[model samples]
Target: MGAPGTARRGPVGEAEYPPLSRRSGWSEGSFSEMKYYEQGTSAERWERARTFFDAKRYSMAADILGGLVEEVPDQVGPRLLLARAYYHSAQLKRAEDQLRVLVERDPAEHYARLMLGRTLQRQGRDAEAEPHLRLASALAGDFAAL
Candidate 1:
C-alpha cells in the first residue's frame, strides 16, 4: 500500500490524481481539446468579455471581443456586445459605427434600434435618433402612449 498522503500507482505507472485546484478549476490536459470559440462561442466570449469589463479590464475585453466580432461578423449578438464594450470604454464613435452596421443589417431589431437611438442622442443628433427610438418603441409595443 502507498503512504497515506500518496497515491498508489497502477500497472501503467499512473498515480491517482489529487483534487483540482480551487482557483482555476482546470486540470492540465483537461482543457487541451477545448476551444474558446466553438458551439457556444459568442455567448462564452461575451461572458468572458463581461467578466473582464466588470473587473475593469476594458482593454483586454475590447481586444478579445473585437476578435470575436471579426470572426463572427454575421452574428448580431457579438456585434452588439462589441459595440457595448466600445461604448463602455468611451469609444462612442466605434460603438456608433458598429450599431450602424447592426441597423443596416437588421432594421427591425428593436434593441439595436434603441441602442442606436441612445448613441445618436448622446451625439446630439436628436432628429436622427428620434425616428430610431420611435421605431424601437413601436416594435416593442411601447409607442401607444407616445
Candidate 2:
C-alpha cells in the first residue's frame, strides 16, 4: 500500500525518520520506509530526492537523501541535499551534524559552513555559530562585511 511505484521492501529496516504519511496525498496509501530506500540505485534515489525537494516535499527528499548519504558517504552533493532537507524540514540537529561533517571534510566548503552556522543559530547557539558564520562570510568573499 504505497504511492504508485514508490515503496518497495528492504534496507537497515528501522525507521530512520518518521513515516511518509506527510508526503502522501495521492489516496493510494502510505509508503514503507524500506520501500523508499530499496526501490532505486543511488543515482535514481538522488534524482528522486531532487525532484521531491524541488516540489517542496522536504521530508520525502530527506528520506531518499538520507539513505543515499549512508550508501555513499563520500558524495558531498547527496549529503548536502540531506542537510538542506533537514534544515528546511526543521530537523536542526540532523542538519547540523551533516553540515559539520562537510565543513570538517572540506574546510573550504563555505556553503556548508554557512548552513552549519545558520542551523546553530536556529538552535539558539549563536555564540557557537559565530565562528562558522564569520568563516563562511570570509570564504564567500562578497557578503556585506560582518
Per-candidate TM-scores read: 0.65, 0.74
**Which residue pairs in candidate 1 collide?**
none
Candidate 2 structure lDDT: 0.84
lDDT of 2 at 23: 46
Task: Residues 34-82, candidate 2: write the lDDT tens digits.
Answer: 5644356677888888999999999999988887888899989999999
Candidate 1: tens digits of C-alpha lDDT, residues 31-75 = 566455322556687788778878877766777778788887898
Cand. 1 Cα-lDDT: 0.77
Global lDDT of each model? 0.77, 0.84
Give the number of the best model, judged by TM-score: 2
* Candidate 2 Cα outliers beyond 4 Å, as residue runs: 1-33, 36-38
Candidate 2, run of 10 with poorest lDDT: 24-33
Clashes, model 1? 0
Clashes of 2: 1
Best by lDDT: 2
